[model samples]
Target: MIDPTDFKQGMRRLAAGVSVITTMENGQPHGFVATSVTSVAAEPTPTLLVCVNRNVSCHDVIGASRSFCVNLLAEPELELAKAFSSSAHRHLRFSTHEWRALATGAPALMGALASFDCELAETVSVHSHSIFLGRVVALHLPEGPLHPLIYAGGQFDTLGSRARTL
Candidate 1:
């Protein structure tokens, strides 16, 4: 097998947009910072997927809720990303920001670049993570230019200054 360390280092070279996957359980919100959210298909139905570590507390909550919201982060939201990703800041994740819910009842960040509210459609088990496929039930696209936060090389960065719409 490829050395896991080497594999991880290689992946760090690929800059990815940051997002927070959120779900609600018993009116309590749970989420985690993730770069593994991606589009699966746009035709037939809008579908996307997020890979989540199965051991995380939010993983089971998401599974049970059968819903989630993928909130795409903006450049100004770096601290929010850090809050969601760190265990020490877990309790503060939702407190620092304004949140609202769409169709799925999953909390969506108020000022996010976009929030894709989804219903859990399928689950696939992998070695250490579970791939959650979600069908878009609703979405929020705030009117503005895009200035996304990105992660690469073990650090958070932004594409705002260099970004241009197609």
Candidate 2:
């Protein structure tokens, strides 16, 4: 049998770019830092996939709204990433940063490298997380310096990052 701890540790080895998944909750915004955002389909209809832990508040909001925006974090947005990553700052998450309404009416970080406005197309429950399949409704990009932020090996990383390779 595979030990869960070892499996989780191994999974962390896969480096991934980070994003903030946003949706509306009763006229307020709900979002969280994520690294599992992925492109599912690209032709006919563009689609994306996001995994939200069933336990998080954003999960319920996303379920209700059936819409969300995936904002790709830039390297300069590390502090913003840290803010959204914590539940304690959940309410304050939208305050410190500038945001604009996406076509889906979801919050898109003003300086994000890329933001995909999406509407929920399908959902699947796998273990503790709910996998949301989103149909892309709009794509937003800004003209600014971009340095994508990523998370791997239990730490946040940015473009131009140097790591020892052997």
Candidate 3:
């Protein structure tokens, strides 16, 4: 069998965009840094998937509330990503950043590249992580340009000098 360390090392090669997954719990906001978010479907109904480790503090609230916001981080929001990734600022995540609830009542970061407001449609458990099927109820996009944060090889990056468009 492959060791977990080696498995993680292999998976880290797959680059992904960074995002903050947030949900409200007992009148307070809870969130975590995530790179396991992706589009699932868009025909009959729009949906996205977010994989969450069940051990995280925000995990329970997300399942209980049945709503969340996937805040896609911009190039300049590296500090926010670091804060959410650490347990030291778990409870202070909301207070340290400015946010306002979206139509789903989930906290949306003020300067995110984009926001996907969703209602939990289903869940599939797989080992330590639970795959959440988020039915997109609303979305938020900045009026200006978008330069997203990229995560790979255990580091954060951006488009940098590269052109922003396709």
Candidate 4:
């Protein structure tokens, strides 16, 4: 049998861009640093999928409200990523970031590379996490060049290129 630890270690090698999934519940904002977000479809409507830990505050908010914003972090936003990733003292962490509500009433970061407001469409439980599928309702792309924040091998990195086309 394959060891779980080995499987985890192997999966960690796959690099992914970083994002913060945000939502509001009971008038309070909640967010979590996530790298498990992916674009699933772009057919009749844009769709995205995000896997979140079931025990996190953001998870609870998403479950209650069925709305969220995926904030694609820029390279300079490592501090924001670190703040949201902390499990201890989350309320304090939230106080350090500037946020505004999107069309879906989900909280979004002020200067992310891009932000997507979405409404929940489906959910499925998988082991320790819940996979949430959302349909895009609105998108915001701020003016100016962008440098993406990337995560790999348990560390945060940056994307340097600003070219839109390959």
lDDT of all predictions, in order shown?
Answer: 0.94, 0.90, 0.89, 0.87
- For model 1, the local distance difference test gives 0.94
Q: Largest TM-score belongs to which candidate?
A: 1
Error of 3 at 47 (Å): 0.1
lDDT of 4: 0.87
On a 0 to 100 scale, what is the lDDT of residue 40 in model 4? Answer: 96
Residue 160 C-alpha lDDT in model 4: 52
For residues 8-96, what per-residue lDDT tens digits would candidate 3 score against the true structure?
99989998899999999888888899999999999788899999999988888999999999999988888888888898866667777
Which portions of model 2 miss their true places by more than 4 Å? 161-166
**Can you write out model 2's per-residue Cα lDDT over 44-73, one digit (the tens) per residue?**
899999999999879999999999999999
Stretches off by above 4 angstroms in model 1 are 160-166
**Winner of 3 and 4 under TM-score:** 3
Mark the 10 consecutive residues where model 4 has the least summed lDDT.
Answer: 157-166
Candidate 4, 13-97: lDDT as tens digits = 9989899999988887878899999999999899999999888767878988999999999888888888888876576656776
RMSD, each candidate, Å? 1.6, 2.5, 1.7, 2.5
Give per-model TM-scores: 0.95, 0.93, 0.92, 0.90
RMSD value for candidate 2: 2.5
